[model samples]
Target: MIQNNAYIELMKETKQLENSVSKISLRLKTDQQLIQAFLDGNKESIGILVERYQRQLYFLCLRILQDHEDSLELVQKTFIQVMEKLYTLQNHNSFKTWLYRIALNLCHNFLREKQNYNKALSHLSLESSGSFNDPVIQEEQSLLLKEFLEELTEKQRNAILLRIYHNLSYQEIAEIMDCQEVTVRSHFHLGLKKLAGKLKKCGLTL
Candidate 1:
């Protein structure tokens, strides 16, 4: 009986050690490493990758779609698509940008089908206004910024949002946008110039 109890305790300790080692291995894995692991038939690695990026992708979709339900749906669809097409991905290091590209393409297609530009702007305006805590000054500033954003072309707005809100570099933005770096720079700078002009008119500086 004592030997039996000792064997059970040893088994428990071994299991605990295995769990700790698994967790440490997961923590040490980079995105590319996770992707490779998934490709190598470790199904759980894909779930880890999803957990790492799902929140960021959801917010990116929400900012573009401006609807919670749509954003949620898009995030699910994005992951599904990623899982289905991951094998075709040539550059594992570009997984993040590739993921964003998929999500953005889905957003663009949805927006195009809806064809409700004015409705989207209205939603954006409301979101902007609600973001401010100060009832007076912040509200006014938000409204002004919303108006400036409304005037920008789609490419210009996207470039500005990706750069400012996401803190993405020009090269990364270009990769996600599937555009030239120079084009992204032009759109961003032109958008900024327009914003500056609008802010100057209101005695504010960007």
Candidate 2:
């Protein structure tokens, strides 16, 4: 009995040490490094990669899908697709952009299948009115902004969302959208112009 108890304690300590080492190693590696590790048959590296971007991907899906449960499901699907296709990615350094592209494509497909283009903008509150401390005023502004966003073209709305919410550059957005950088700028500017006109008509400026 004493020998069995000692062996169990030793096994527990070994597992704890292994877990600690894995976490530290994961933290020290970049996304590219982790991807390479996974490609080299280290399956544990993929978990770290998922942990790194799961939340951001979730919100990205949520913004486009406008459904909490659907967003969660899409995030899982996105990672599964990534796992299957990771071996085919040529530019490992662009994994973030590639991951986003996959998620966006999935979102677009979901939207098309559901025929639901009117994505809710509640998660995308306008930042121009930071002075509005009143919750009622904030809600009103959010609804107005949401309506305006819904009016814009899908490309325009996506460009604006990627730029503003994700803080991606025009080049990055272009890569994800599979469009030219100038085209992205054009869509964003045109969207903003239309939104500005609508806001101005309502005695608001953005």
lDDT of 1 by residue, 1-206 (tens): 99999999999999999988886787679999989998898887888888888999988888878999998999999999999999999999889889988998898788889996656754563233133465676667777887778888888988987787778999989999899999999999999899878877987656
lDDT of 2 by residue, 1-206 (tens): 99999999999999999999988898689999999999999988999999999999998998787789999999999999999999999998789889999999999888888876564443444455446677776676677888888788889988998898999999889989999999999999999999889987987666
Candidate 1: worst-modelled 10 consecutive residues by lDDT: 123-132
Q: Which stretches of candidate 2 lie over 4 Å from their true place?
A: 119-137
Q: Each prediction's Cα lDDT score?
A: 0.84, 0.86
Evaluated at residue 167, the lDDT of candidate 1 is 83
Q: Lowest-lDDT window of 10 residues in candidate 2?
A: 119-128
Pairs that clash in candidate 2: none
> How good is model 2 by TM-score?
0.91
Estimate the Cα RMSD of every predicted model relative to the unseen true structure.
3.7, 2.1
Cα misplacement distance, residue 108 of candidate 1 (Å): 2.0
143 Cα displacement, candidate 1 (Å)? 1.1
